[model samples]
Each structure stands twice: as C-alpha cells, then as structure tokens.
Target: MSAKYNHWHKSRHSDPNGDCVEVAKGSGGTIGVRDSKAGTPDIVLELSRTEWAHLLTRLRNV
Candidate 1:
C-alpha cells in the first residue's frame, strides 16, 4: 500500500532497472507484496506469516 502506511522493503540484490518487488509486514502478522515499479498503492499479494515462510522455503529449494 502507501508508503505512509506500510513500510515496504525491496531486495538488496535488485537492479537499478526496477525489476523487483517490495514486501511489508501488515496487521495480524500478514505479509504484503507489491510491484516496485508501480507507483499506485496496489498489493499484488498477501500471505500469512506461515505462508510467507513456506513460500520462501520453496523458493530457496528451487
């Protein structure tokens, strides 16, 4: 969402071309992900803490 409301963090490895996404911890321990290139406050994905951990584990395995 908006930066004023959500503190979004981008990957440290992201390139200058803006090919990346931002993530933030939301209320009730939910996680929000959004496109870094998009200026609008649009959350592309939302996951619970456990779901986020599972996704990261799966991604690391790949």
Candidate 2:
C-alpha cells in the first residue's frame, strides 16, 4: 500500500503487549490493515469500504 495515509490507529481493544492490528483510511476510500507488531514497512491488507463493513459485521457476529 502507499505510504500516504495521514493517520493509522490501533483498535481500542488491542492487547496491552502490542499484539494487534492497526487500521488506516487511504486514498480512494480504501481501508488499510496491518499487523501492529510487525514494525514499519509491513504488508498492508487493503479493502474497499463495503468489504470493511462486511468484515466488521462478520467479526461482530463471531
């Protein structure tokens, strides 16, 4: 993913030891997710807004 995201935030329920995911809003309304413990230059998973919403819904139901 591009390095142009203005902000990236960790989940409010993230583990205190830093094992969690970070998410950011990117260009063209895409969402980016990456491993918080992976350090910089990690692989980012990009998803469309619809995909993100669907994922959250599925996760909540789980």
State TM-scores per candidate: 0.75, 0.83
For model 1, residues 1-62, the per-residue Cα lDDT tens digits are 32232788887778898777788888656788877777776645778789999999998899
User: Which stretches of model 2 miss by more than 4 angstroms?
Assistant: none
lDDT of 2 at 18: 77
Measured with C-alpha atoms, the lDDT of residue 23 in candidate 2 is: 89
Best by TM-score: 2
CA-RMSD of model 2: 1.7
Could you tell me the TM-score of candidate 1?
Answer: 0.75
Per-residue lDDT over 1-62 for candidate 2, one digit per residue giving the tens place of the 0 to 100 score:
65445488989889999788888988768898988677774678889899999999999999
Positional deviation of residue 8's Cα in model 1 after best superposition, in angstroms:
0.4
**Model 2 lDDT, residue 24, Cα:** 91
lDDT against true structure, model 1: 0.76
